[model samples]
Target: MAKNNRTLLLIIFLLGIFIGALDTGIVSPARTVIASQLSISSSSSVWIVTIYTLAYAVSMPIAGKFSDRYGKKKVFTLSIALFGIGSLLCGVSNYAGSFSFLLAARVIQALGGGGIMPVATAYIGESFPIEKRGSALGLVGAIYGVSTTLGPTVGSALLNLVGNSNWGVLFLINVPICIGVIITALIVKDEGIVKEPKKMDVLGSIIVTLLILALMYALTNLQFHDFKNSIASTKVWPYLLAFIILLPIFIIVERKSLDPILNLKYFTNREIALTLLISFITGAGMMGIVFVPQFGENALKLKTGSGGYLVTLMAIFSGISAPLGGRLVDKYSPKLVLSMGFASTLIGSSTLAFIVAKNPSFISLLIGLAFIGLGMGFCMGTPLNYLMQTNVDPSETASAQSTLSLIRSIGVAISPNILIGFISEAGKNISPKLMTILPKVTIPGSNTAVSMTQGGSSSISPDQLAALQNADVTTITDVLKQFSGSMIDKFSPMLKQQLQNSKLPKGVTADTLVAQWKSDYLAQIDAIRSSIENMFQSTLNEGFAKLFIGAAAIALLGLIFTLLLSRKTKPVSSN
Candidate 1:
């Protein structure tokens, strides 16, 4: 193949990846808006992302097999067309105000989007000579990184410019890009060797798709319903059972089949299996991209359009690091490069966890994101080097990569759902703690006051005097005990300042002034309690911070797998 043609093909591949990446990033910032417009809860609207990932995971292996069976050109072009059509349908669904249609459209988009990556990867793996393949894949990874980084910013900008009410523009933006990809793809000469027609793994595909759907459905349901009380309450148990039963059956069928959608033999390779595991773990950690925008808006209190900027930092660093990582893979060992990448990710995630868990400042968050991006770039490129080099057969490259992609997608799909469950549970736990600290008081005019003030000879009733004394002493003591010493220290100066500014009636006695101050202090405590209870955003911030820690832990676990890569593994030849 001519170098010029290869360049053109690479360009087209990058564009395809860009569109897919763009769609993925674009949706995150607009999620709250989309939920409101559709009259759905925020938790439910996450299906907008979950369904796409599930569908993408299910479709990748099938698309890869189809590409191997037919030709890359045919499958690639078809995938782009489906994506465009899905985008159109999404736009139409938005216009029609139908959430069901929107979900259905996303499934269609996933069907096409899933094919674009694996097939493009297979094409490059086959077309490029071994010496250059690493760099080629690196470039592909870099493009993907840039697209992901830019997706949120672009989406946010579009949302801001067009307004959230027109959220469909995010989906619609893909149409023209897809058309361009289709046109560019047509110009690339198909030069790869075509394989003979083999039996399609229709049964395996169906079983695999069902398995993914069932598992994702079950996992997602955890956010909306309880799993322990009623197993059959929301189809969660049934779906989980379906997934459990299908697993062994799918394995048996795949091992016995002539053309398995996912060849079981690949898992026999320790390096490949471990690489796939690492991908899954890494995918889970990568949920930072999906949730960080919300965290920024809800936690950091950033403007709606600016929430994605933090992720953009991660993306930018990833893009910068990808090509460099690829070069390191070519020059040194993939194991070394991959380990370094994992370390970077661990550092990034830990930093983010620390910042979020403590006092999160925007600058500190950006620094954490930068580390994450750098880590992502290295992790993304190095794993492909290991997978392609160690376990994949040249002819079955697409299928192998797709299998890895499918598993990784599953990891990504489950992470947000699980993390969301954690966040919701955290909120539930914290709400009670907040309630316990609420002020309990009895004012002077109340019945409780009548008994204590009986001996008073003033205009105020004896009961009222007693109640005022109870409120000023017992209630205040209890409220003060709830706060830490440091908090009380902080509270005193502010209270004093407020009291100093307060006006008193002329000729009031010192005793009366003291009573007035007590009343004002109790009122202030009540106000603070009310504000805390009403501010659900604070609970959300706490939940997000906890999830960030979880993500960091997952990434740290993935780093262990990177260390386990076999030193003796070598690149498989395409001969």
Candidate 2:
């Protein structure tokens, strides 16, 4: 290939990666809006993201194998075409008014997007000589980091420009970009080797796909159940059973297969196995990127479009740091660079967690996100990829890259689910505290004997109050109704007596007093309702703070694994 062709190919590869990374996060900012439009709960709406990740994770290894078998140019062109079609379908689904259709379209999009990154990485790893690979791959990683960072910001901007009613524009924007990618991909020459085609691992692929699907479904759906119930209930048990049964089968099948979808041999390389595990852990830690927009909107009370600015700052820094991280890898050992990257992430996460828990300022948020971006730039760019590439034979480059991609996807897919579940349960736990904080309103007259009590009435025992405190919305509402009825009973006689004492003109009756009392009671109810809403909002903010702290802890855990990378390993150069 000529120098110009290689440059063009690199540009095209970066573009492919940019689109995939963009798609992963663009919907995050507008998630609540999408749920409202589709008349779905927030939990169910998250499936739009979860399903895409699930599909992406399942398709990556298969797509890698296809690229190896069919050639990079062919696979790359088809992936771009599929992505374009999927984007079109997503836009169509928005108009169709079916949540299921939207999820299906996302699946299609994921299938295409999944192939782009691993295949593109493999292409670069193979195309560039070993000495130049770090910098080249660093540029690719930088593009990915920038794209992921910009996704929320770009999506929010598009939502603002087109109006939130036209959120479909986010997905639609990808269509033209994909078309360009496809055109460039076709013009590029295929440099992949042609060998005797090996039989694809069809059985291994099915088992692995099913296994991942079951595990993700179980984990994501846990949001619907209480924490304890989620552990013990039959609802998630079947999926757990499926995962348990499938894992050993997958391992056994891969060991036996001549051409496995995922080669078990990679596990023998301690560095490779460790890198993959760290990739998954780091991927989970990166969930902060996805949720920061929501945290801004819900907790910090930022306007919908403004939340993305923080994400943009993070992306900008990541882009700047990525190439530098690559250069560092070239200068120093990958383990050293990786350690620095993980350390940056730990500091960033801890800073954000503290800020969220105490008082979140735009400046503080920006600074924290910048650190995270810096960490992402260093950690994701060359260090880990270099480690994996160095451990594998040249022929297994695509397979190794795909396996890494798959685990990372699994991590990303499950992170939000687990975090959201924690948030949900935390919110529930705070509800009783909110009830205890309910204001003691003076009933306005000594003549009225009614008083607000913890359990609503004297007849209600301690156990009953506890039950009411732990009850669902309907049960709580019923308890409120009973309390209101008792209050009315106490107030009615006093109201009538007061009305009787008043010297009214002709035609004024007791009914007029009753109507006035009814209006006053309704106003009181409205005031109480408003107070409850405010309390709920406060509790939610607290929940988000806890989640941020948890995320930071997870990042710190990842730092440990990152530190464990072999210090003795040296950078390989093309001689």
Candidate 3:
């Protein structure tokens, strides 16, 4: 009876991990809405998102060791409490406050919530036998999938629920759940403190934390502020230089630390090392797929709220593919399961480029996204099992697994940032096009086009207004396409010229014309979109091809790592 109850408790605590994960995607859908109403930039709210994950990245490995020393239950309880605090703070932040405050609070929230997963994994593995491990791991993955799916939906629902009460409600809602998760964690007892030669290395932890954080900041920011253009700027130089300096320090410190945050000994083992590398390699390309739907809807001229559905369609495929791959891993071989998953994504990315080359249909997204999602699900979990079985004794499965879990996490952070670097590199040649007609273009903040405020002419009849609106949509789209294509075609030269000149047009007199240009730019977006919508299928097909080409190329890297795997993989043993 006690054992069964512990299982229930651990399962409940695992839900808390998704509380943080949900926040990752939750703020994503609501970003534009929140940023607009707050009179701030989308760039501001995006930090509300990327920063949390960034903070979480630095916090995870630290959390695991703290759990090891202090006890999982204590770490678990503290994490939820902090998560609740962070959520409440976020919900209440108003127009009067600063964005920096929110980021600071998120980092604190990260410090608090980081240990929940590693600790939860630590405890659950101790409670369950090896026979039950795979299923238990699957349950955890399922929970994550459910959390990620529900994140956007919940975010959307909360936005509506509060009815412009603002994004505070999304944060506020987590408060109650965190309260509940905490109570359950407190009721659970601590278990296992197997004394080994290893000791938790505090200095090593700090070095690794700094190293990862610097690298993460460097990668995520690279696209937004490219090194190519602004290589000399402090933003690029400071972070990148710090990363370069600290990385060698981290590796050296880890070698000497009594308990290295990362166990380098594993690097000597070909199978374990290679499989983990495969995980990281394949993950590198997936970063964009997660956010592509948002870009497609918000930036690419698709209607709002449509982005989530587009993402959902792809997720549906991945969700379906993962379980099928799981079964294959169980029945056939982990090698085949992983290799096929990587291959499927490669094909899917290639197909996606073609589908998205034009402004494609929502249904097409369903097919392409499903294929990739399925492939990911099939391959994701079995790698951890390989890590668990191959490293350490049977008695140390949980510890070994938690160590690998931390590595998987570092990969997750590193991979997306790498892909962001790639995707941004792809768009380096691309440019944001004007969307609407010039004469009608209502420079956003100004009132010129009916597109901005609607019904440009007070003297015009209703029928005329309707006709104007129809024509305006097409005109806006045409201008936008031409402008965008021009931006891409001449981005390199244009940027270079702009840097050299660094001057606005003759009439413009402002510190930052870029901001004003954005408004006009957004308003003008329709001009280019009509053409895009007409050629949607072909355009998306092209986009899909480009995206897959990258995903596949990266997966082939993963495939090479898999080739380094041993001749035989261990099957799922009996429970």
- Candidate number with greatest lDDT: 2
* TM-score against truth, every candidate: 0.79, 0.82, 0.74
Candidate 2 lDDT, 1-575, residue by residue in tens: 88888888888888898898888878877888888888999878878887887788778888888877777767777888888888888888777878999988988888998888888887776787767667777887798889888877777778889987788888899999888888887787766643346887899989988988888777656543356777566757788899999999999998888788887876766777888888888778777677666566554554435566777778888898888887777677777777777778777777766775356666776777778888888877577777777776666666678988888766776687677865666556654654464444334333443334543446555665555554332234335544544555556677668767877558876657565655565556555764554454456667677677777777777778877778755433211
The per-residue C-alpha lDDT of model 3 at residue 403 equals 55
The Cα RMSD in angstroms, rounded to one decimal, for candidate 3 relative to the true structure is 10.9
Q: What is the lDDT of residue 118 in candidate 3?
A: 57
Clashes of 2: 0
* Ranking of all candidate structures by their lDDT, best first: 2, 1, 3
Instruction: Give the per-residue Cα lDDT of candidate 3 at 471.
Output: 27
Q: Which candidate, 1 or 2, would have the higher TM-score against the true structure? A: 2
- Per-residue lDDT of candidate 3, residues 1-575 (tens digit): 28767765766766775786677668766777767766678667778767776777777766665665566667678878888898777766744355666677777777766666656655654555544544455445545554665578678877777775466677777888888877776776656554353566878878877877777766556543354765566655787899899888888987888766666665666666676576566546555466555445633456545566666665566566555554554455567767777777766665565654444455565566676676666555544454345344433343345556555665555555444544444332222111232334333233544342243334344653343233222243553434433333333344345534655567654424544554455444554455544443233234334555666788777777776676565532211
What residue pairs clash in candidate 1, if any at all? Answer: 449-463, 449-464, 449-467, 450-463, 453-462, 454-462
Let me know the TM-score candidate 2 reaches against the reference structure. 0.82
Q: Give the runs in model 1 whose Cα sits over 4 Å from its true position.
A: 38-46, 223-233, 294-306, 429-545, 573-575
Model 3 poorest 10 in a row by lDDT: 428-437
State the RMSD for candidate 1: 9.4
lDDT of 3 at 3: 74
